[model samples]
Target chain A: MTDRQDRKAFFRELGKYSALGLEMALSVVIGMGIGYYLDRWLGTGPWLTIVWIGLGFAAGVRSLYRAAVRSGKDLERDEERRRKPGGP
Target chain B: MRKAILVLLAVAALPATALAAGGHGFSWFMMLPGGERLFYMYAAVFIAVFLLVAAAVVVGGKKTEEMVIPDPRFTLRNLFELILGFLQQLAEDIIGHHYKKYLPLLGTCFLFILFMNLIGLIPGFLPPTQKMNVTLGLALVIFLSTHYFGLRENGIAYLKHFLGPVWWMAPIMLPIEIISHLARPMSLSLRLFGNITGDHAVVAGFMALIPVVVPSVFMGLGVFVSFMQAFIFTVLSMIYISGAVTHAEEH
Candidate 1:
């Protein structure tokens, strides 16, 4: 690609990645907000809020973890398939 | 050569500069505008930007069918497909076959962070990720999402994952696990906030000094740091998610 085209592509990729990051961040914020509100409603003080909020955060992390594992395994499988004779 | 000359000229205009502009020095949060503090602003900006982008996405989705002009730039559909494919591959590799459900969340997280980090490179913009509140918010989501998925996947049994291998250790192990789980968000937020903030500060500091060939190198480093931070954040999130989804099996 021409230099200008490459630059444009780079910016586009950057924008795309930024969007992804924002989504993840927002999810955490939303989860925390919900946990806090639930705690207030249930009259559990800080304890329940902390616990449920922690749970929400954990759920987010778990999803992220799962994505990583899936990506890694898929790469391995693809590599293995590529190595196999007449695998195409 | 022209770019180098311009950089030098800019540097020359600045007053006396600190010796180590890029060092991880302490940032005074209270000193910011109106004593409003860094974290508070960070939260506000993150929420505002997120809402704006979300609205844009919704509007864009609604207009997907119509094309005003045949522009050579990549179309929204093509971009979405690319992102979907990337996220799908990531999910499938990590969660086995159930990757479809989590794709939207993971994909969105990765793309948003990547752009936020890149925004710092612009001349006048400060990256939202550089602030602790933003990172904290992001980390908090990952922290919560892990358990949410856990409960959804295994119900009450999800809590059992934190109880340790044997019943004897449940009392001690539960608290320990809880503390460690709490630390995840703290670590995630600190790591991102520290790296981006430090890198940006350094770039600014360097440009303030020697006004020569030096700052460009730091700018390159800034780019590298930005990309690495995004990758690490995504990887950690994935690890946490998979752990929650498959918690019951190992225990």
Candidate 2:
């Protein structure tokens, strides 16, 4: 491939791949944010915050897993197509 | 749909009303002549501009794709193709073939929020998004609309989504679902508001310090942040909407 085309491909992959990480991180952060506030309001003294953070981590990991599987399927599809005759 | 629109507008307008009505007490000094009235008008004006552009695009563009327009000028048709085309790609990328029906809503949203965010970079104007009321308003519309789409797609069985996998966990699961679901809008609004407000403040701060050079730097950053926030908001909204419909396919 040409250098310019390679560079464009690199950036596209970079952006596409990093979005999963960002989404995962944001999920945990959102969980923590909600947990921290709920703790403060309910006077749970960190228990709620702890629980919410845990939930947040679960949510993030769940999203990451979803993303990984989705990308895996896409890559497999691409490979299958490439193995086919007359494929791009 | 009309009633839903009215409700969303009313919810969106509530904070502006309270701010204007109660301004005599706390924010008397900060109040401009028109006050929150003017604050809300910026969004109104954006909506008006959105309608105008859409109308122009609809009129200017040919109905059929076969009609050729090579490198068309900076006309509404070109602008329409550029934005709508990108949004179409975005929706399809995120949600697959289920994307077309949502294009108009998502397209309008991206265009409106992107412009609204950029407006603050210009001097003597505030981005409607900086106000929690406006952000909340946009979020509420998405929140309700996504649920509507979810229910339509999945049937009333969608409520099982709130209930956990095991039936016994419903009590614990429901609240978590509600809070996390509610947090979608909270985060959506606050993230946009916080980023834009912080960016605007820094730009204004720098503009005050050295009106000539430094603010331009912040202005450039504002452009980047504005686009990123718009993108994040749009993509997240798409994810939430699609998740409601396609939960079974993912796992």
Candidate 3:
């Protein structure tokens, strides 16, 4: 592939990953927000929000961590392949 | 023809015995007790099934390699090859070139889900996909996998995709986009869970009440719904992955 095409492909892959990360982070925030508002309306004194939001945050972090670890592994694999003869 | 009629007569009498037995042959999983405990069972079942299938595939592939079977006439290996070939075609069609890299993840998700859905059709078995935890776990994997690809492709600049096109709209668009993004997993998980659960429940209820030829119609509907849910989940995942992999410049 030409440099421009390669760059485009790279960007496209980047966009995909970014969108996924954003989706996950947003899920947590919205989950927490909904819980918080519901608790407030129900006179639950922020307990529901606190707990749900915590869960949401935990879920988000877990997703992010997994993504990071997978990416790291992929990078290592690529590096190893590059070091070997006749690597792509 | 006379023997067939006699067999049909005996088959018709079987349900009476089954009904008289009581309990409907359903295990504890069907009870669906309150709280999130059901989620744990769902996760455990999903993981167990996944591991079992993975191991089977590995062992079966090795066994097939060692076998001296001459003809490729409809064996398990051939069946797997057919499935993998179809999945590869599907991946290429949906995701374009270099789709081989994604075949493992996407194919596994699709097949696992499809099998889980079909499992519900068995008399006593419950489809793990009918539960929220299983669907959620699959959604979580897709969600994370997309980001892993994104960050790997662009490093820190991957975050820029979330900022939107215009700088001013970032404030408003970010939250809206985020809400929609968050909804993807919820929608993915809940849509599969609700459809499968509802379909299975309807069939069970119908079988309980009518206990006759009527439940078959609902069972047909359940079958259709199960396939549709699997298709929807796979298509949506592809869409999400394609959207992530598409370059902002192209837009």
Candidate 2 lDDT over residue span B36-138, tens digit each: 5665454546555876777765665666564464455686667767767766766775677979888778877787888888876655456777778888888
**DockQ-better candidate, 2 vs 3:** 2
Chain B TM-score in candidate 1, rounded to 2 decimals? 0.73
Kindly report which residue stretches of model 3 are placed more than 4 angstroms away from their true locations once superposed: A1-88, B1-25, B28-71, B248-251
TM-score of 3: 0.64
The digit string of per-residue lDDT tens for model 3 on B86-157 reads 666555644658677777788778777877887776665667787677889899999889777767756777
Best by TM-score: 2
Per-residue lDDT, model 1, residue B108, is 67
Clashing pairs in 2: none
Residue-level lDDT for B109 in candidate 1: 73
Query: Which parts of model 2 are misplaced by more than 4 Å?
Result: A1-88, B1-33, B50-54, B57-71, B249-251
Residue-level lDDT tens digits of model 1 in B1-251:
99999878767644323322432232332256653446335534564586467557645655545644344667664565565565565556556578666666776676677767876765534677877778898889888988898899989998887887699978755644564566567767877888888888788777667545687798899888887777667656765677788877755
* C-alpha lDDT score of every prediction, in listed order: 0.64, 0.69, 0.65
Every model's TM-score on chain B: 0.73, 0.79, 0.78
Error of 1 at A67 (Å): 15
At residue B243, candidate 2 shows an lDDT of: 74
Q: Using lDDT as the measure, what is the rank order of every candidate, best first? A: 2, 3, 1
